[model samples]
Target: MTNYKRKKLDAFLSLSFCRLLSVIYIVHLPHLDATIEVTLRSMVASTFSMEYPKANRSFTSMSHLRRQLLPKTKDMPSGTGFGLMRLFTRKSPRSHSSKKKLPAGEQESESTTSTMSSTETTSIHRYDSGRRYNARQDIPYLLPNDEEENDRAHQQHWMINVAFGSNFDAPVQDALEKGIEVLDSGCGPATWTLEMAEKYPNSTFNGTDISPRFPQTIKPPNCHFFIHNIVDPAPFPDSTFMFIHQRLLSLGILENEWDKALADLMRTLKPGGWIELLEISYAQYENAGPKVTLLMQSVVTYGKSKGLNPGAAHVLDDMLTQAGAVNISSRRVAIPLNHGGKLGDLFWDDFKDIFMALYPVVGRLHSDLADIEEYKRFLDACKTECSEHQTALYWYRSCGQKPSNDE
Candidate 1:
């Protein structure tokens, strides 16, 4: 072959190689392995507009190609090698040190480490202090005690009860059979306590909340209600109770606050006792009715705007696992939140009826409810839907237990 033709063929091969290298590194290598090699490859491909596949071959066959294209290298590029080397092996300015030591007068620069440590300590203290302030301010709103109807604690209790439905009865039976005593932290209105006491007279149930919404007339012999705020540690002694249950408490808890709360619950449980937690993970909804998804999305957005944790839905599993809970299991229940299910379907009928009763409570709580009229129309449609077909709302239930023996 002529020198000119061979040179052209080599040039074409070089371009093809560059493209190949770029693709493999950019799209494939990073996924296959998380190493400094992939990072370096990314730097090269991104810094230069060289296609990845071509770059891959150029990188692999560089030694042989370098000898073949010696004449072209001199005329073709000067900074390419230096650029690639710099990209592949970056040096930190902060890490580099000068050979010359500091003068005696400048020896105090060593204390910069101490200065940074002190600054970090101060920053952490300030952050914690700010959180304390926010929590205190939020407590009154989160756990309001006023009895004039539509109160925060009342609404939360109702929401939780409706959320659990028949599943609540099963747990009460299980706890009773297991001879478990319950400390219902942040309990409002003593609904579960009252019901459990009636159903399981042998098992003891204690309900505590910052709010004093305990029903005077609904008192049961086996059930007791108290006032306690979980912002501080629970007042009960460690390893005392058999089972502890809490639900629908995300509004009152910030992220990671559940750790101390769970630890406290575990501490309160006996060695062989269980602790059950049920949270309505508001984010997991599928096959939602027409306005349900929109309303849910709006509510989630508004919750975030109001400084609530929209991510609270999925954090419970991690939180429970982190808190040393064992035998963790979760179930996702899909209930249609709209007005389009048959009365013959038990879950759907109850779901529609509950939404009709509860959406007004939600409307009272949220000022940004433009769909109030639409909600009513949907309720009427739900009534019609309930008579015709089966549809319902849904929620997720996750439960975990503390270890029987930490040893």
Candidate 2:
């Protein structure tokens, strides 16, 4: 062969050898056996030149191939010899971290979950603070998704029922008894779903949340859980529900998204199906002192930083009306912070649960308190002030019906 031809062949062979090494290194990763090294050396020798026999060839090419093929793994610890093979690794689709790609024709799952209880569970994607929650690029809920939060939600449920004196204002029980379908948006722990499913065995309940915090080990036959984002177009077809319910989504819903949220609710329900939205806000509440107000203001500020309007709950009356619902009724249920006997105690626990769960995030996000201890002291003082002044917050429950054909 001409010198030029031999040189070109040698270069091509060098790269081919590097590629072969790349595959071998990846396949046998942290530990390369003697057999693999000998095979690699033989392949390199045979492919590159006839001057050296396969077995007698100098194995100096290993160092050369390492230099030519591998990319540095800065984040990875040293001495694994995986640095060069890292170049062939694929970046994680979401975070650009080093990861292995699944074999051809295989697709990754959306989420994976492990359960500790039938009432509450956690997905692999969960991020725990005081409670478990999954961080998403879309929603900004801070609470955790464990059994404690689940029980807390159940307690809150009772407190809400006591405050309102009924499970619902609209004839949801009537619809359910007739074997209708129900969709519970942001159904944390599926407490409402389980209860309603047992109460109305004929009705099917679909619960959805961004986190896999729903009951898994034990669930009613009619109740199902779906991981979903309410801001997006719901998975179901338009007008599929008989009754759609949502509560306490104010943590994620923003001022502008209210219109979209209401619109989505309207799109989700059948004609004349009732939609009840319950939200808690600081609008026109009584007796919150500087510490309480400060904590509340910090929450509002932190929510705004995340592009949410914490106070948007107060404006749902207009938004719901604009979304093309008729016979809209708004009920503001007052929850005594420190005044109403056993009811007040439950509400206090509910409030404290939220405060405790969010306390860490609040300190990081917003703090009117001086330090950790000061925040604790402030909370203790708020409890006293609440009882002395009959401090209470209002839960605005607004029910609306889609306009029927007759309308």
Tell me the alpha-carbon RMSD of every candidate. Answer: 30.9, 22.5
lDDT score of model 1?
0.48
Model 1 lDDT per residue over 1-407, tens place: 96535544564665556456544543453255446555644443344321122222232122212223233334534554423322222221211111222223432221122211111112111111011111234452222232212122322343444455643522346658656677877666555565555566678788887656665323445677776777567778888787777766665665546677777777787776666666555565554554554445554555555555545657667777887877777765554433332112333433433343334334534444324455556656654543444334445566676677753
Report how far residue 303 has shifted in candidate 2, in Å. 1.3
Look at candidate 2 and give me any clashing residue pairs. 70-84, 131-144, 132-144, 132-145
Cα-based TM-score, every candidate: 0.52, 0.67
Alpha-carbon shift of residue 363 in model 1 (angstroms): 8.3
lDDT score, candidate 1, position 120: 11
* Best-matching candidate per TM-score: 2
Looking at candidate 1, the ten consecutive residues that score lowest on lDDT are: 124-133
Write one digit per residue (lDDT tens) for candidate 2, span 109-186.
Answer: 443332211111222333333244554546677566654565567567767777899777876776689899899998
Lowest summed lDDT window (length 10), candidate 2: 89-98
* Steric clash count of candidate 2: 4
